[model samples]
Target: LEIQKKGNEWAVVLDSKYNRRIDANTKMEVSGAAKKEVLKDKKFAYGTFANCANGQTPWGTYISCEENFDDYFGSSDENLKFDENFKRYGFKTKSEYGWEKFDERFDLAKNLDEANRFGWIVEINPFDAKSTPIKKTALGRFKHENAEFIVEKDGLVIVYMGDDEIDEFIYKFVSKHKYVKGGDTSKILDEGTLYVGQFNGNVGDFRGSGKWIALEYGKNGLDESKGFKSQADILINTRLAA
Candidate 1:
C-alpha cells in the first residue's frame, strides 16, 4: 500500500509499482527462536493477514500483527481434538472464513502447527518492495492489538503491546541489543525479553504501581515441568505463560 502527493492533495496509489499486498497465501520466513522450535528449521510461514492494528520502528519498518487468525482454519471431525495449548489459544473445530476448504494447511487435522505460525508480529521494510517480511515470535504471540516502540536514552528499544481482550493483559519487549543509527535493526525484534504487566493495588486506585513480569525460560517455573522447554516455548505460548 502506498500514499503519494497528487499535486494539490495526497492520494492512495493502488496501482503503483511499489504497491504490494500480503494476503493469506503470501509466503514469509519465521525467524528467531520460533524457527528452531515451532518451525523446526522449516523457516517458511504461509501468509500474514487479518491485520487489525500496526506500529512502526525507528528504522522506518512496519510491524503488521496477525489478529483473529484462528477464524480462518479448522475442521469438522468430532475426533479431531486439540490439546490445552491449542484450546487456550482458541483454535476451533470450524472456521469462519472456511479457508481449510481450499488450503489444507488451515485444517487442524492436516497441519496442526500451521495455526501456530500466525498471531505474530511481522516486520516488513516499507522502503524495499522485494524484502521478505519476518515473523518476530520472540515478542510473544496472542491477539495483539498493536506494538508501539520506545527508544530509551541508552538506545535500548522497548516495545509496548496489548492483547486486545477484556480479561487479557499488556506486554512489553526489551531488545537485547541497542539501536545504532543507520545500522540494520531488522533482527533486533527477534532477540528480546518479553514481559507481561502486573498491576498492583486496588482497582480504583489511579496511583497504582505496575510490575513487568519476565516471561523467560526457567524463570518463575517456566521450564520443562510446566511443559516448556526453552524461551521459544514460553514465547509461543505467551498467553499461557502470562
Candidate 2:
C-alpha cells in the first residue's frame, strides 16, 4: 500500500504491496455452538480488550492476551439462569463496565453467545501496521495472564499460558507441525493441541513433579458422555475440560 499526501488527505497510489499470510483463521471457525451461530462465516469479530499482558513470537509477531475480558459482558435479565459453563467462567448478572445496559453485544440476555467470543489469545504482526490481529482459539480461551513461546530443537513451537483467575489452571499448546525457517507460518498456530498442568507432589513440596494432561476430545472422560462433543467444545469450556 503506497500512500501519498494530497491536501490534508491520504490516498493509495494503486500500487501493489504484498501482505503477509500470517493470520490463524480461527475467527469464523471458532468454538461454542451458540457463539458459532453469531460468528458463522464471519472473518472478523468485535475486538480484544482488557489485555494487560503481552508476548512475542519467534516469528517476530506480538501476542496480546485478553485478560479479565469477562468483566465487560454480563446478563441484563434479572431472572436469567446461568449454565455451568457460564458459571465456570464467572459471568454475573452485572459487569464492571455495565456495557450490557447500552451495548447489545455485551448483554448476555440479548446476546448470550457473545461472551464466548472473548477470553482469547490474540496475535498481532507488529511489522504490518495494516494487519488484523487473529484470536488463536487452539490455545484455549480463558482469562489469559501471559503467553511464553518456545521453539524446541525439533522446530516445534510450544506456548505456555496462565489463566489469571485463582484456582484456575495452567495451559500449554504444542503445534502439530514443525516451524520452517523463512517459510509459510500462517496456519502453524491453529494446528496444535492444548494441555493442562497437573502437579504430583506433597502439599509442602517446593519442587514437585508434574504432568501435562492433553485436553483433546475423545481421550479420557472428555467424550460426549461428559458433555464434550468436539475439540472446539473442550477448547471453549477449557476450565471445565481441565
Question: Where is the poorest 10-residue window by lDDT in model 1?
Answer: 34-43
TM-score of predicted model 2? 0.83
TM-score, prediction 1: 0.94
- Per-candidate TM-scores read 0.94, 0.83
Candidate 1 clash figure, as a count = 0
Over 4 Å off in model 2, which ranges?
1-38, 203-205
Per-residue lDDT of candidate 1, residues 126-219 (tens digit): 8778888888988888988899999999999999999876789999999999999899786788888889999887656566778999999999
lDDT of each: 0.85, 0.79
Per-residue lDDT, model 1, residue 155, is 92
Model 1 CA deviation exceeding 4 Å by range:
203-205
Please write out the lDDT profile of model 2 over residues 91-197, one tens digit for every residue: 89899999888878788999887787778888887566566677778888889999999999999999999999889889999998888889788777888888999
Please name the candidate that would achieve the greatest lDDT relative to the true structure.
Answer: 1
